[model samples]
Target: MCNHLAFWFGKDPARMDAMFRRSGLMREKWERDDYRAATIGKAIEGTPNVYDPNFGRRVGIRFGTNPGPGPGVTSGFSPPRSWDDPTRLAEDYLSGRCVRVVIDKCYLYRVDSDKPERNDCWEPVSDAWMQSDMWQLCVAAALQEWERKEAKRVADNEKAAQDAEENGEEAKQKKPEVVPPVFPAMVNSALLDTKSQSRLFDDTKLGTWIDGDPNAPHPVRVGNGLLDLKTRELKKHSPAWFSTTKIPAIYDPKEPYPVKVLDLLKYVFDGDDTRISVFQECLGACLSSKLIWKHFTAFEGDGDSGKSTLLNLILLFLGERNCSTISLKKLTTEKFAAFDMYGKAANLSADEAYFESADEGRLRELTGGDWVYWEEKFKSGFKGRNITKIFFSCNRMPKFSDKSNAIWNRLILFPCENVIPADKKDPIYMTPEFWEGSQSGLLNFALDGLDRYLSNRRITFSPKIVLAGERHRSASDSARMYLQDNFVEKDHARVATHLIYADYLDWLAVNGYKGQLESNMFGKEIPQLFKSAKSQTRDGVRCWIGITQTTSKEDLDFRRNIHPTNKERARQRENDSRGHTSYGQAYARLVEGNN
Candidate 1:
């Protein structure tokens, strides 16, 4: 805005445009040179030009004054600059000297000046030296309105004359000739000089870019200057023109930023540096445009252990605008939930209501960078690759039924087992004041973690954290947990097959594990649990080898005389659902018939 204003307030607009354009060319040269700082600091004709000057004087100052340190104060202090300075455009701004003038949008564009299409040109009386031309525009508009009224009046009178002639009566009035409005005459060049600006740009290049191609069918023109993603040194560019979301926080790697915010990671991960290391990598991954690590982090276990704090901190890091809070369950169940994933850097699902969710391949597709369809309400749907990183913070471990590593491998867990006691808990950590000056330091910390992880190109967790992650994953698989609790892998250990089944039923009954009735599920899921375990018949009794159950409970024969065959049980279920005879009575009738 200042640049455009400065160029507009120039005494000779053409000379100012030429000078600024020259400055732009010099800037391009400086960027390509090895010593940009040295070249810019030097002068061109006694003018130090290596600066982004204000009021068309972005160049270095010729004469300046500085007040030396007063007794104890450090130097670098100066009184307010006087208006006599060559660059002082303060008067023009504060006094409203050029408030009524309309500057061309083309002059406002400050990047990639070589492209004529990028310039926003004057078109259809728009960006006219508007204030001065306002009166003439009003007069022309009024004249056009009068012409329209005259045309309508003549048409009505002519119709009446036609009707009278048809009736064989002489017409009372002659046909009135409608005179059309002519274009407004040009003004004198002597009074207002704008001819030079007309020749500054090619007439054919008008409305080629910012205003779009005038001849095309529905030409699209971008309005706001957006952050240029390619070369934004922390996104401080003047005219980006496309991106909507930007990191409001600046990233400076060399600055000394002290942040205690990362202490939340230590507390949540039980102060385990290895798990914290994996966590730091995850933090850094959130900063990227696309999924870098390609995994969702699950921060599980006890409340009041800083998981929420860590979540808020990450939310702060990736601004609330850049991160989406839609749950993973919604991706499969809700209408158009996938659309929320677009344009977001990370998807943070923190609600525990759907924490234990059943993923139906959509979660894998979303985090795996697969191009998926996004449906927007009342708008044409489009396909975009999912770049959003996913994170789930829940008290309960997530439930997934994928038998493969598709879902399990993509989940990394950070255990929040260490609870902050009532007395030791500090409310200050949760307050806004605690987060100040933390973004820069947190960014640096994440960068360090990123560097370490990229060395191997994969996140490495210590054996303990790896075990904890697997344990958390097994929370949904009762069979896996049952195996872990009652059995141990051994070279030659053996147990009667019936005995193992009998013990599984007792364990289920005693533990009161929900949704689990210990009959057919054990037979089906047990065999799939281990690799080498197999069945063998020893002296007429079948036995399972290579595994042993660690229990002292006496095994009751699961296959008793009352026990029905698998086929009979399945038929009984179907019959019950169809309102047939009771299964016990039906079994008795079959036995009596055999007798």
Candidate 2:
């Protein structure tokens, strides 16, 4: 027989109570030391077994190989050294050997006052031990059952809530609200309708070469007008213009994108026509043939100059067919170019507010040349290419070093000085519809004009304008041709230089100059225009005119001359009065002696 007594606690209390009620297990409690015992059986009517009831303790198993008679007594068995040893009483409790004794508290085990049965039944111990153990087991069991049921209920509620959330999301997606496409009056619904046969463009109307090489990765869609993909999902006040006018077609930087510009330049050279007729008005400036300006354009301006507003109008007029807009902050040059330009969506830069001045290095890359390279700067260094067009806005003009070769050469400067303050400008923001309509009106007009001009002419920079006037025709031609051949190459741009000697000569002619131009003649004009223009230069730079002259002022000032008639008149008057020899002979002597 086992020497230990097994005491089980944490029994189901409800079940235990039912058993107690049926079996007459409840009785008056008696105190033994710090604990209380419930009386059980007529044999132990007033014995203490249960402990202080209110202070709860974790119900678990305890094994004593030899139990003492009273509640607090351990039968000489101290706590074991290790909890895992099987032979040890401490080990048995820890190894869960005691925990596995499943107690059915609903059934009471009877212990005879004078007799003992097998291990399954309780032995006749102190009345106190029997009474207290019974009550504790019943209470613990009922609490355990309650906890289990409560956990199940909580888990079920959470699952139901999660399922409802998922269902709600599905319902929303099924009936999503659609956003109507925005368009100008000129881009009628008929153009977009299925049955309308009014063809906006056909193969012939698109010109001979609408799409480029079939094998080319990104092909141009010729017949489609610009397109704006809109949805209610987007936020308001978002910028959305693609190309702007201020940027140039070809930029010059340390590294040139000769390879990249080649393919697009081919299309421009081939005369691929492009036109913009948005909102029933042609852009005053037209863009014809994707070849001339196959690259992207950015527009930068001061705050509230309607940079984003203008771009949005362009998108609206383009009508979700030929154009799309992105704010500048999101633009990644390499990633943007790999996509299609002629698709219904035109790639655009995102909305961006400019700093007071441009970062000189970045401005150089954007406008300087077709490509820019810096060796030690940014390890991989920026190598940008084929930036065909750009529209950007800045609060102030870009700051650049006079010595920086890139930015000074590439940028085309245009100042958008509004006649009215931002607050006084037309209230285009009264309503979305009104704002959209008016902006489309202005943008379409400008784009149309640009398209027409670029399509018809190969714009060559005329240096003749540098020397404007009807009088200096021959001299102007000589100066203009020399500057072109010697300075500006066919591939390079024509810079606005007042340093042209022909311009200086024109200034002299227009101002009414005396003799033919001479080497020292620059000294005369310098005292005038140079004061202002010279201040614009940095220190240590010398200016040269490169002009030839025919005469010298020194030669005219120093040459000896004879005044024969005047001297003779004086001498004749003197002689009439004093009989003096005439001075004509003296004058003749001076001339002859000098010769």
Candidate 3:
């Protein structure tokens, strides 16, 4: 019985009851001692009586003196007798002697509950019991109880909600909706997609508010409204404007600026008011390359003139990533070099090398907003149009091979003539620390320039700059120089076209000028110099009738001394009859007269 109880209830009756409760079995209120006693009593009282025919009508017989040897039992053999009577077995069970009773090889047992049998209320003790239908009943009961509790909980919740709604107390006790924080927009315009921009900003606005920084596409400091460039309408600002680009806190318009606008402009332009104005206008154009097309800037100065420093400040002010570096030589020599300018607001080159005359057409195209094809390494070529504003700084202007005025018309030169002495140079001006410290002031200055450019719609150049450009053009062309020196007005003595061409070539060789133009080219360019001059053929000789060769003092003296002899005059007349002069004879007479 103890072993059976250990296997069924895990060695303790209290544990058995706890397991039943956990499984929702609803254990009955009964002590283990009273249950054991009642179970043993029932088993004993239910025992049946046995009859022995050998005992001669006695139901249960005890072992008496056997009457000698019976007929069935020979000598030393006796009739079998019951080992113990049923009454004695019953007494042993009541006295607790026989704790367990076996009937038909099975343990005596009974369910202790007094109520009607509920198969669902019983839990299985082991695998054998689980295989029976009782374990399924227990599982079904557990699930049903769970469903009941859930239904009750839901009903209570619904009732509470209904009661609150009817009383109007929910409105008074409700929590407020939370609003997320707003931050500045910071993203490069080149990187942003149209969908993203539309979602962040209002589509209707007067003028597009472009943040001056090329690296940062989003506006960090904006007023209550912004303008739309495409629509030309004003729209209110939205708090949803957000981007990954980080704007420094110093750029806040609400904060005090570190440097005054005038002082900042002076620092960049070195107190040259003309340069300052021109540069500011250019800077404004750089802010929005799409608005202004054509026109590039050239900064002409030697080292230590602060031109490079000025460029660095501009790059810092505009976001360095928004600018790209490219050499003029590359722009002309490389087929796909223009690809580098894609998505860039400004392209800067310092100390650029000279370009051949062939590059002039490409340079014009770059500034003129023409579509150009470019290819990257190991990729297919594509066509793209760039509006990138160009800036070049060099010690001297590049020599252009094109004689046309196309290049000159588009170039705006700012002569940085003020060289900073070594003693007075500011070592920290170009340092990173200086850029970080003065970013706010520089941004404010650029904003003012932007406003001015938008208002005027065009940049105006000073007279000094115009003169400088002309000088620059003249210095590069030897043909222009030769014409200016040797050619005179129509009132002077006329020269034949062949003689002038010969003199020009000789002058080029003597001066060691490279890449001299051919005679046909010279003929084409001469008309530009003497606009009123016309060509004529006299006796089959080509001559320019209107223009004359300028007479130098030495040539005039030679002519004065040569009251040409009658012999020389006859020879000159004979040569004139042949439709051209014998230059050798004319020179020999002059030599004779000098002697």
Q: Pick the candidate with the highest TM-score.
A: 1
- Each model's backbone clash number: 4, 68, 10
lDDT of 3 at 536: 73
lDDT of each: 0.52, 0.30, 0.52
Writing each residue's lDDT as its tens digit, candidate 3 over 445-536 gives 55566667667666665775787787777678888778877876664234566666756655665566777778888887677767777777
lDDT of 2 at 123: 16
Better of 2 and 3 by lDDT: 3
Those runs of model 3 whose alpha carbons end farther than 4 Å from true positions after fitting are 1-271, 354-358, 435-458, 488-495, 529-595
Structure candidate 3, residue pairs in collision: 187-217, 205-228, 205-233, 205-234, 206-228, 206-233, 206-234, 207-227, 207-228, 208-229
lDDT (tens digit, per residue) of candidate 2 on 157-229: 6676677698874222222122122223212221122111111121121111111242322111111122211
Those runs of model 1 whose alpha carbons end farther than 4 Å from true positions after fitting are: 1-245, 354-357, 494-503, 514-529, 534-544, 555-595
TM-score of candidate 1 against the unseen true structure: 0.53
Residue-level lDDT for 478 in candidate 3: 81
Better of 2 and 3 by TM-score: 3
- The positional error of residue 158 in candidate 1, measured at the CA in angstroms, is 32
